[model samples]
Target: MKMEDYTVEFCPWCCEEVVIHAVGITACPSCGKPLAPCSVCWDAHGGCREPCPYGCAGAEADEQKPVTTPPITQEEIDFVMANY
Candidate 1:
């Protein structure tokens, strides 16, 4: 069966077999294990954030925060101009 086909579940955190709904992907109702989408050494979005549809917290796995574009300020522009 495919991953999605896993209607039944084993919570990685609790590591016990669990009852899953038609499309559940988060906590195990029994043990409350936070399940997440597993990728190649990372979550698919390239951040520590849970990729699981249910957004289950996983193995302290993601250490990196998401990258963001810093806001540009007029002072920053002036500093760049002065330096350049």
Candidate 2:
């Protein structure tokens, strides 16, 4: 089969098996859950191209996406307990 015929199938979020067929290039299905376009690899995802990092579950893009939530801090927990 041709390369384009192949699909980079993968659910951007749930890690489900989603097909990135020739036509599926634009973006994944925007179902109930929020969707965001791949940040690092924009439209290039077309043609079932390179694999995505974190895969994004196809949510909407944003100027500021933490991408990485802050690690839990002991001081913060302590304060919460103190107040309680």
Candidate 3:
């Protein structure tokens, strides 16, 4: 089912299933923080992805992984400056 079709939800913080009908409420109706989404891991999938920084608090237990990013070196910066 699509994420939009989900009306009832389980709060990650409080671990309680909540029936959400309003669009304005973002937090868990039970513990307020149960449904908090990780800003760094949210994607177009309508839910948190793997290696969630928030540890997937209320979703499931999984081994945490490291976040990797491309390294920027001074040589690369200099080359860009020379061209642009």
Candidate 4:
């Protein structure tokens, strides 16, 4: 494949660098972990040419603020501990 047809990424599972092709499910040669695009890479490529096998199509939206619950009050924690 042409140089532009692939990307090099570090595989965290295998702790090694791997070559991921843009056209297919590129798995890590060492640990068999599928190399999928992250938000950074997805944005860099302006989106993949095909549907990603790992279903990371919405990864680009991760830049948005994460949904989080409000902090629990000390009274709430005390009530739970007392009941338990």
Best by TM-score: 4
lDDT of 4 at 45: 54
Error of 4 at 9 (Å): 0.8
The TM-scores of all predictions, comma-separated, are: 0.32, 0.25, 0.30, 0.44
How would you encode candidate 3's per-residue C-alpha lDDT over 1-84 as one tens digit per residue?
A: 223322455555566665432222344445544332243236788677765554544434421322222232345434433443
For model 2, how does the per-residue alpha-carbon lDDT over 1-84 read when each residue is reduced to its tens digit?
A: 233332334444566533232322333332222223333245553432244443433335521233232222445334433443
Which residue runs of candidate 3 sit more than 4 Å off their true CA positions? Answer: 1-6, 21-25, 34-84
Tell me which residue pairs clash in candidate 2: 12-57, 13-57, 35-58, 35-59, 35-60, 36-58, 36-59, 36-60
User: Comparing 2 and 3 by lDDT, which wins?
Assistant: 3
Query: What is the lDDT of every predicted structure here?
Result: 0.40, 0.35, 0.41, 0.48
TM-score of 3: 0.30
Question: How do the residues 33-56 of candidate 4 rate in per-residue lDDT, one tens digit apiece?
Answer: 555544234645576545544554
lDDT of 2 at 22: 35
Cα RMSDs of all predictions? Answer: 19.5, 17.6, 16.9, 18.6
The alpha-carbon deviation from the true structure for residue 4 of candidate 2, after best TM-score superposition, in angstroms, is 3.2
